[model samples]
Target: MTKDHVNYVYDPVVLKGRNTEHPVHPLILSRSSPREMSGEDIPDRELMALFDAARWAPSYRNAQPWRFLYAKRSTVHWQKFLDIVKPANQAWCHTASALVVVVAHKWTVDRETGKPKEIPTASFDTGAACMALALEGSGRDLVVHCMFGMDFEKAYKVFGIDRDRDGVQCMIAVGKRPALTVRDREPRVSQRNPIESFAFEGGFVKVYHK
Candidate 1:
């Protein structure tokens, strides 16, 4: 584990009622995506700290090829961010505190070898960064909802991102949710699928069943 992972702490509330048979980090097992977010703005330093965690995510050969561009809610860039989202997403995401564009490059030079390394799986590396960011946001009592229902091509054009060279993975909405109302109470808590459903023991031939 990286130093950041080792130092990460989570709220006790997140651990409540989680299965003891197969222990997993509460942050990973309990994190949820809020459909509605608070309009309140997040401090710039806090946002930067989350990005810092993403920056340190492990990558193939340390290619470190993820880039993020964000627009703070209530700013001039907010409309640009909103315009890219699908109408369905706009209904909920407009209330997000911030919107970010995630980009990934397909290749990078190996620092030690001074040769270009083909990153056929750049999206996987970028996903790792997104996971780190999500965990960091959760640690701060914030929610991060990733959305792919957006005009990614248009966004790439607007942002001057070369789609041929860089891939626009998805947009992330980061914020705290508004206080839960009576109707919203039930959906506030979420659960994840059992690990046995996805995890294998030694190989694909050996399926672990709970």
Candidate 2:
């Protein structure tokens, strides 16, 4: 593992400042996925800013195929969106300031062939865009949590998503994090697998071990 990331995953005290030994930005290390959302609505401009950040993520063939469906906490659509989430997820997520559904175009017409072809990187690129949105929200001190704990069939029906062309990629809950209540579970940061476990040098010829 890179020393900085190792410190980040194992030693909180070593990650005290932006200029800590970590090689990346402090925002990355500090961001957390918290379930205790404050239920306050985000300002419209602030919310759009997150989307604006997502707009810049790179994609294959320059096909930025991601689409976002968003609903603020108090809107009629918000309840409808919340109802699609599993009750376990909704128990914590209903307090989020906004619910964002990430979708991707599964197929795009080939410009040259004039025929539809699967965009192999559509889901991959959408995930990168989601990270961009997450980083932007974290920079603004907002907590963002992405999930798979929703009813995809219900989501497709409610959002009018044509599954043949579009994929319901994932869901995100965004809000200013709230203080944990006694009844609420304790908030804790999770660890990551060491970089050594995943990163390879020349090729996938060999894997690193601690």
Candidate 3:
């Protein structure tokens, strides 16, 4: 990680625009992905700690299927990993300390039939794992940005992941942020919709609720 990264204080501007209807953990409000990074290497132990958090994410049938493939900066695998990202994302990702490819197994043994069955919640469970990793990174005050603008198919080939058996979830960029100045105008934390818009009492709510 960058020098003083652990000691650096975040600018209040990052927290200015967010508000919530119901109270949540302060960390939830503070976590926002920004593209700016310090281009410094993260310690191996710190990175592993974040993955440890992901390992605990809940999965259906206890079928913990999430797999993370990563390459750290200055490593032989770094260029190969960076090359798979689309040109647009590569612009900012060049400064990232680590790049992670999230993958999940597509099948699990059916308990009843003892046969191969598609894991219905593979994507959902994998996403939960990613969120846990992201939250852990956030709590550590690290920049952990997830991106979908990469070549998903190429990831399977580059990382030797079986496309038929495993699904590529997304790519994540992890690094330390450069010092923020008063002039730095990074985007503020995003606002989320009210719960009533997505949550319902009994049945699905078809219309958009303000």
| Maximum-lDDT candidate | 3
Q: What is the C-alpha RMSD of each candidate to the true structure, in Å?
A: 4.4, 7.3, 4.1
lDDT of 3: 0.84
Model 3 misplacement above 4 A: 1-12, 111-114, 181-187, 208-210
Candidate 1 lDDT tens digits, 93-150: 9888899999998888877799877787799999999999998887777878999989
Using lDDT as the measure, what is the rank order of every candidate, best first? Answer: 3, 1, 2
**True-structure lDDT of candidate 1:** 0.80
Better of 2 and 3 by TM-score: 3
lDDT of 3 at 161: 84
TM-score of each: 0.83, 0.82, 0.87
- Give candidate 1's total backbone clashes: 0
lDDT tens string, model 3, 1-210?
Answer: 343334423335555667778776766666778888889999997899789889899998988889899999889999998998999999999999999988998899989999998888999999999989988887787889999989988888777888889999899999987887222665555688778888899999786545
- Find the 10 residues in a row with the least total lDDT in model 1: 181-190
Clashing pairs in 2: none
Least accurate 10 contiguous residues by lDDT in model 2: 1-10
Q: Check candidate 1 and list the clashing pairs.
A: none
In model 2, which regions exceed 4 Å deviation?
Answer: 1-22, 179-187, 205-210
